[model samples]
Target: MTVRVRFAPSPTGMFHVGGARSALQNWIYAKQQGGVFVLRIEDTDAARNKPEWTEGILSALDWIGISRGSYEGPYFQSANAGEHRAAATRLYESGRAYYCDCTREDVQARTGSQYQGYDGYHRDLGLGPGPGHALRFRTPDEGSTVVVDLIRGEPTFENKLIEDFVIARGDGSPVFLLANVVDDMTMGITHVIRAEEHLPNTPKQQLLWDALGVKPPVWAHVPVVVNEKRQKLSKRRDKVALEAYRDEGYLAGAMRNYLMLLGWAPSGDREIVEWSVIEDEFRLEEVNPSPAFFDEKKLRAFNGEYIRALPVSEFIDACQPWLTGTGTIAPPPWQPEEYDADAFAAVAPLAQTRLAVLSEIVPNVDFLFLASPLIDEAAWTKTMKDGSADLLDAAIAAFEALQSWDAESLKSTLEAVGAERGLKLGKTQAPVRVAVTGRTVGLPLFESLEVLGRERTLTRMRAARLRLV
Candidate 1:
């Protein structure tokens, strides 16, 4: 059989980071097996599904190397309603499933607890298909179901403990479990590699596959991604959207590399590796089944390394979106005409090393472009203290007299001015840095001053001095 793996995601909201991880895994696995990768939009949740959300899924998959048209049908699960319904009917006709009219309150009244699920009350009652009648599978009362997973070892679920789940709702529409299995069967999905949270429903899906006279796909349940507190990453709580990271200046290469390392790592002692290396070395069997922590700090560090690794030309191009407020990125501090490309190119190398993400480029270089520096009140309150006017006076006088207006000369001149006051370069430049950059922390002080030019730098200092008075 041709190995076919599908990434079936619900078009409900943002393309989740965990779902992105699973998609990449599925994409790679299909390639490794010389199989086909299928993109199926489980657009069944009508209440929440939207066209834009489906497009977002396609766009997200494209962003992470699973480009459009490189894979099989972006088949919609809703489009296969006939097949889903046909399978449910077949299951009912074959005695593998039965119709039930028991309501939630009726089941709870009988079972004596709300936590207890369907009691299979109508299993042998032979309630025919009618309004308010639901179809449920007849789970075997004896043996256990063993799910053969590649990453996790075979997990066995006893038949007695496994409840007969609903295949179709009272309205005759198939529910997720049955629809999911039917869709997989229709598309010939050979392997179901997905997040570990789905492991609980695997036995049910596997049972559906068996009842439909089709063999179940091989399973691989990757570890669930968690936050620092070890809680499963939630949409409402965590920054789980993949698009947010992309828009925030995360390089696709860095994201793909870091995401793959959530539960598995490449050979040797390195977390950061190339895409080609990851594609070659990734194995489902080697993936750890333990919960993987989504360390935002570590991913940021990884992105910094990636940003620094880029050639100056590529880095400049990469920063354009965030620089000019393209798409969803907010506009920079400076206007279009105010932004000086030449000045930015000069400080690009310095800024490259300091950035964890590309969005940080705007603030670090904002002083160079703006007509006047955007001062930080806190930095001003901290740095513009006793005798700062005198220091600015002396520094401005010394700088105004300079023949050479460059970084090295600028640094030596400032150092001399600080030495006269019995201060070090750090103490001396703190005031100058705040006067110019509007922040206590930023790109190097002397280098930024060099790029800011002699006249503008002095004007800002004088402005800061006037503010002090």
Candidate 2:
């Protein structure tokens, strides 16, 4: 059988990390089997769905490199309303589904408030289609539903306890079960891989498929991603939005790598392998059955490793978007016209090692582009206290007389100045570093000074000397 998989997401708001994980697993499975992957938008929940949210899902997928070319479609589930209605009508006419004109209050009154689900009061009422009635599938009362999940192994549910679930609402609108099964059948989705939270709904969907007399797909419900508190990540409580991570300067490649490791681990000791390695080695059977923790610290660490692994030029290129700003991210302190590519290229190497995300590049090198650096008051006070004036003055004179204004000469000159002052280079360079870069911690001091030019360097040092007075 050709492995066919689909990532059917409901566009309620921001594209979530949980949704990304599911999509990625499906994509990996398809690639591993050399089969087809499909993107289906389950927009049947019209009240909560938005066009912008749908666009966000597609954009997020593209950002993470999930393509549509090798796949089938981003087919909208709502578009197949006619097929869904026809299926519902077929079940209703075939005695597999029946109209129930009972409300929650009626069921509770008949079966007491302790009753959990629909009591099936109208199951054999022999009622035809009418107002104030929902279409519920007549579940078998004697057998069991064996969900043969690949991840968790086969789990059986007693049909007696499995309530007669509604397939369509009172207004004749097809619910999730009907829409989902109909689309899966019509689209030929061979494997139903999704979050473990949807596992309970599978037995009901399987029953729907059986009622419709169509073979259901293989079900593999992976573990749900939870927060530090062990609760499922909620939009209100957790920063789980995938686009938010993108805005915060995370590389999409790193995000994909980190996300893939949430519930499944590769064979070897390393988790930072390339995408091709993952595609070649990924297996659904090896997925863990337990909950996966969405640990931000580990993800950040992974991102840092990926950032350092980037080539210098590509790192600079990646920092460009965050430097200028995109969407809600405000631009760096420096003006766009003030940005000097060659100067930044000179300092990019120093920033790359210190960076965990692309956004950190701006703060590390913003001093180079700004007309006047944003001086850190604490750094200035700490480095240029009383007794530091002579140090700054001496360094200014040393830098001014330099024949060649390069990193090597600047380093040697500064070291010589520190020696004359009876201080080590590390000790003496503190005041100079604070004076020039506005912070003691930043890109390498001499190299930054070289890129800033002799004139600007001297101007800042002299300005620092005068400020000490």
Candidate 3:
């Protein structure tokens, strides 16, 4: 059989990180097996689903490099409502489902809130479809439904404990379970790889599939992503949106790789994995069932590594959005005319190494574009607390006397000043560094000074001398 899998996401809001991981796992497995990776938007909930949210889902997927060429459809589940409703009707006519007129208050009156679920009071009502009745599946009362999971071992749920959940409302609109199962059966999704939170839904879905006489897909419930406090990633409390991460300048490749490692490890002790290796080695069976914490620190570390590995040109290109103020990062502190490509290229290599994300590109090199560095008061106070006047005066004098202006020339000049004052280069350069660059630390000082030119460098040093007074 051709292995087929689908990422069925409900387009209710922002495309979440958990959803991204699930989509990635499905995409990987599909690619590895030479199978179909499907994108199914289950957007039937009119109250919550919006067209913009659906667009957001597709945008997020494409941004992460999971493009249309790699997979089939973007099938909208809302478009298949007629088929879903028909299946629900078939279930009703086939005696697999029946109409239940019990309201929540009625169910609670009989089965108390403390009870596991709705009492089967209306199970045998034999009521025909009416305005007050909702269609419910007829779950077996005496047996257990076992979910044959790939990641987790077989777990059986007692049918008695499994409430006969509603399949469709009186208005004939199919519920999520009904629509989901019908869609999965029609799409031939061979493996249902998703977060572990959906494990409970497995037994219910499996039962629905069995009742409908269609085979249930293989289940692989991977671990749920948690926050620092070990709580499930909440929309209200956690930064769960993939767009949010992308906006913050995370590399798509890094985000994809990190998402893969949440609850699954690559071959051996490797963390920085190549796409080819990930495609070859990814297996749903190897996924862990334990919860995975979404550690922003680790993700940022991975991003830094990925960013540093990028070719200098590619690194600079990736930073264009941040540097040119054309993308997610807000308008850069400096103007567009001040953004010199050549200057940035000279400093790109050094800045690339220091950044964990592309957003850091601006702050690290903003000094290069601004008229004068935006001085950090604390950094200035620390470096210029004492003897700053002498250091700036000496730096201005040595730099002004220099006929050559290059990293080597600047290095020698600064080193001579340090030596003459009996101070180390780090000590002697501290005040000068702060004056030229806003922050105390940044790209290589000599190289940066070289790019800033001899005149501008001397001017900043003299400005620092005046500030000392």
Candidate 4:
């Protein structure tokens, strides 16, 4: 059979990281098998679903490189109301489902429990309606429903434990359980891969599948991604939104790599691998049952590694959005177009090694583009307090006479000038480094000066000398 999968995220809020991972796994599996990956928006809940939230889901998936192929939707469940209602009506007429007039108070009074679940009430008592009736499925009271799961492996839920769930609301709108099963079946989704928290809802869906007489999709419930506290990732308690991470400057490739490693690992100790390799090696069975903790530190490390591995031109292009705010870089406090590309390229190699996030590139390199380097008070006092002024003055005079502005000439001249004043290159470069770049420790002093050019370098050095006076 041609393997097909669908990622159906409800447009209630930002696409959570858990949902992104689920989408990614489905995408990877489909790609590996040369099958189809469908992007379906389950926006049946009109009360909570917003158009912007639905768009956000698509944007997030695209940002992470999970695109729809062959399958043309984002088929909204709201759009498929006709199909869902039709299916529910068919089941209702076929005796697979029946209308129950049991109110909240009636179910509670009958069961002597506050939990609102329709278990024996639907099966023991046949379909009867008085007022405010909702359609409920008649679950099998005997035998167990065995889920032939790809990950969990032959998990069985007692038929008695499976309640007769509501297929449609009293107002004739389909619930999630019914909508999900119907959509999956209509889309020809062969595999249902999702977070483990949805495992409890699987039996109901399976039961619905059997009742509807549609062949059930194979199930693979990957473990839920949790926080350090081992609780499920929550929007309230955790940074579950993927957009927040993108805003904070996480590379898409790094995020994909880190997420792929959450429940599965590649060959050897290397955690960073290409997407093609991940697609080739990725298997639903490899996913562990235990929840994986979302560690920002590890993700940052992986991001840094990916950033450093990019070719210089690609790195420059990647930094462009952060620098210019044109592409994927969302509008924020930092403006990348106001930045200097020559200065960035000169210092790119240095910044690349030290930066964990692309956003860090702006602050660290900000000193280069400013009108004058903002001298840190402590650094100014420490480096220029005593004998540093003579070195700055002598270097300024020597640099003033230099015909060519280049790294080699600048380095040799600075060293020669410093040696004449009985100082080592390191101590000599300290004040000049601070003067040119506003920091004692940064990119190579001469190369940075060369990039800044002769005029600005001399001007900043002269200003530093005047500060001493």
Best by TM-score: 1
Estimate every model's Cα lDDT from 0 to 1: 0.92, 0.89, 0.88, 0.83
After superposition, the stretches of candidate 1 with alpha carbons farther than 4 Å from their true spots are: none
Angstrom error at residue 426, model 2: 2.7
Write the residue-wise lDDT of candidate 3 on 86-126 in tens digits: 99989999998999888788877776685547777777778
The number of clashing residue pairs in each candidate reads: 0, 0, 0, 4
TM-score of 2: 0.95
Summarize candidate 1's per-residue lDDT along 1-469 as a digit string, tens digits: 7899999999999999999999999989899999999999999899999999999999988888899999998899989999999999999999999999888899999999999988888989978999988999999999989999999899999989988889999999999999899889888889999999999999989888888888899999999999999999999999999999999999999999999998999999988988989999999999999999999999999999999999999999999987788887899977898878888899999999999999999888899988887888887898889988899889888999999999899999999999999999999988888988888899988888888888899988888888878
User: TM-score of predicted model 4?
Assistant: 0.87
Off by over 4 Å in 2: 326-329, 420-422
Lowest summed lDDT over 10 consecutive residues: which window, candidate 2?
Answer: 65-74
Q: Whole-model lDDT, candidate 2?
A: 0.89
Please tell me which model should have the higher TM-score, number 2 or number 3. Answer: 3
Pairs with backbone N, CA or C atoms under 3 Å apart (clashes), candidate 3: none
**Segments of candidate 4 deviating more than 4 angstroms:** 68-71, 110-112, 115-119, 122-131, 328-340, 374-405, 408-431, 464-469
Ranking 1 against 3 by lDDT, winner: 1
State the lDDT of candidate 2 residue by residue for 9-122, as single tens digits: 999999899999999999888888888898999998888999999999998998898854656888999899999999999999998889998888888888888566888888
In order of appearance, the predictions have TM-scores of 0.98, 0.95, 0.96, 0.87
How many Å off is the CA of 156 in candidate 4? 1.3
